[model samples]
Target: MTGPVPENGQHHDLVARLVAVLRATGGTAAVCTACHAVIPTVDGVGLTLFTTHARFVLGATGPLIEQIEDLQISLDQGPCLHAVHHRAPVLVDDLTPTDPRWPAFASHARRRGVAAMFAFPVLLDDHPVAVLDLCRTTAGPLSDTDRRQATVYAAAAAVLLRADADADHGDGAVVSASAARTQQATGMVMHQAGIDAAAALHRLRTHAFDQNQDLAQVVTDVLTRRLRFDPTPG
Candidate 1:
């Protein structure tokens, strides 16, 4: 995720450009853009757990974004979930006073001090895939200008994600379903050779769990000859 810092002049120039875009469009402070992977480049495929391509966060909205993600994983429902499932934007203007559409989410969000939320789907070839979220602390519908700005950001995110995905796939950096199946088949072959799938899975999981590393990284190690597994004697 780390990269060379931009020269002061270049840094200021970029910030100024963003500020000009936001100001001309009347956007509020606290704007941020994020891609799915830790590294924004296309080569970091399968390195992170981003289901969506990229997202934009604004103002005090960052904390709420984490809270909402946790809530969705806990309560198993919410706008982000819908955005991912149905591939469409989910907008909630007010969290207080209850909204019939998301009774559980509203109650939980209100308790957590969230007032408004918006999620826009990122699309590829007219098919929605990822989500871009925007939020506000104060309770009220998003102003027209804010909505426009959010949409613009979402559009930019969609373009970036599409380009990244395309590049990764084209360069063989991204894993495909067939590749995953092949890897699984290879693993099964090793297991059938008496490697022990459960034990191996456990060992891998244990190593990753103890190291606080990603499961995918563990798998990569196994595939890349960096790690080896030996079955215990029964």
Candidate 2:
């Protein structure tokens, strides 16, 4: 299992193995736990599901993974978000402070001992429905076989999450209170500044970092009408 799977049959077998485990476990949390056990190269895993309205952190292997997800949520950038946007895997063998893709996220994650990251988009009906994120304490590329397994795990996660969504009418992916508030503030900023979602979120992140305030507090200020984003001049 150190190199490429070498054959399509082997790859399908890997997917079946994980899909079985996912079905037996019957939940996103169990999917993450199982993925962590099987993917030895990764130190932590997080799963995020995106619906029409919002995204949810449906599962995480531990606190480190949860913290990484939170950082991405606040900054509005990271491998997980990128994977979802590109509908493909985003693999970083080393996360360094100078990485231009996500400078702030890379710096903070490196300080937290996350030396590597891999994010795979989970697809259902050819549409990306979620991202499966892996974090490693050591900086190195994943073995080809391990990377294949990660892809399979992400496929299995999509199955489990889709089932969960169907059962609860998608309400199971409850946006956290902070996340809901952040979304509200982002909408407010969008209306005020005549900008899109991405720009509004970036503005919120900038204000939070500049003021040395927590993102939630910044959102609170926006929601309370204490802070506003004025439309920039053309």
Candidate 3:
């Protein structure tokens, strides 16, 4: 997903603003807020920090976006993973069910009403450590200007993360918190569907993909009693 500079022209002022904001604040939430101020085309912003032994959801603008990241974590696939693994941006201008790259992740995100997705890896000291992601509710790739600005934002995130690594509470704490919630939902699936843990999780992932809904969302419904599994696909 590479492109030429946008015809509308460069917004260097916005890039400066983002860098200043990231420097002013000590957290990703503040950085996201700053992004919303400068970038008008994006709907949500997310960050994921990866280490050799653990992976964590660094920060995000809201619950929807956090869940989007969680879905990828649960399934271990998607554009975000691709970007992290390849150390390049994964830009899906128009996300569609026909795409086979991320069978489960793509379908669920599509159901969540995400029309476009972009993920860029963040590096510090020449090693990749995090991903900066953007989700668009409207269908299309980010403008060249927006994409360039995203790279700027990603750089800021990488710096802040390394500067205060101790503040983050090591051991994948952020991701582990979300993972615990997922396990609760998984247990619900097992009980309602009368299956083992592995089977129940498989059922949840399959059901979400088949229905084009997010895995975390389906799990939420089950926990809330809004949905139930009958030991059979329906």
Q: Which candidate leads in TM-score?
A: 2
- Best lDDT among the predictions, by candidate number: 2
Residues 1-234, model 1: lDDT tens digits: 123445767644654565456444423221232222211211111110124322211112233454454344344456665776777667777666366766787787677676876766656577654455555556666555455444445544444445446666431123333235324534743564466443444455456546745445666676766766655567
Please give the ranking of all candidate structures by lDDT, highest first, separated by commas: 2, 3, 1
User: Any runs in candidate 3 off by more than 4 Å, and if so which?
Assistant: 1-20, 166-234
Per-residue lDDT tens digits for candidate 2, residues 1-234, read 246453778766767777776667655657677778878778998887776655556677776886687678667689988998889899999899778988988888888789999999999887888888999999999888678778888877777667767788443443434455767898999999999876787788778667756666788899999998899899
Tell me the spans in candidate 1 whose CA falls farther than 4 Å from its real position.
Answer: 1-61, 169-234
Residues forming the 10-long window of minimal summed lDDT in candidate 2: 169-178
Question: Lowest summed-lDDT stretch of 10 residues in model 3?
Answer: 169-178
The better candidate by lDDT, 2 or 3, is 2
* lDDT for each residue of candidate 3 in 1-234, tens digit (9 for 90 to 100): 466653433434544455566666644545555655566788888777777744556566766677677678667888889998888889988988657988878887888888888988887776788888888888987877778778878877765666567565443223323455656777887888888776776677667757867656787788889988887755
Candidate lDDT (C-alpha), each: 0.48, 0.78, 0.72
- TM-score-wise, the better of 2 and 3 is 2
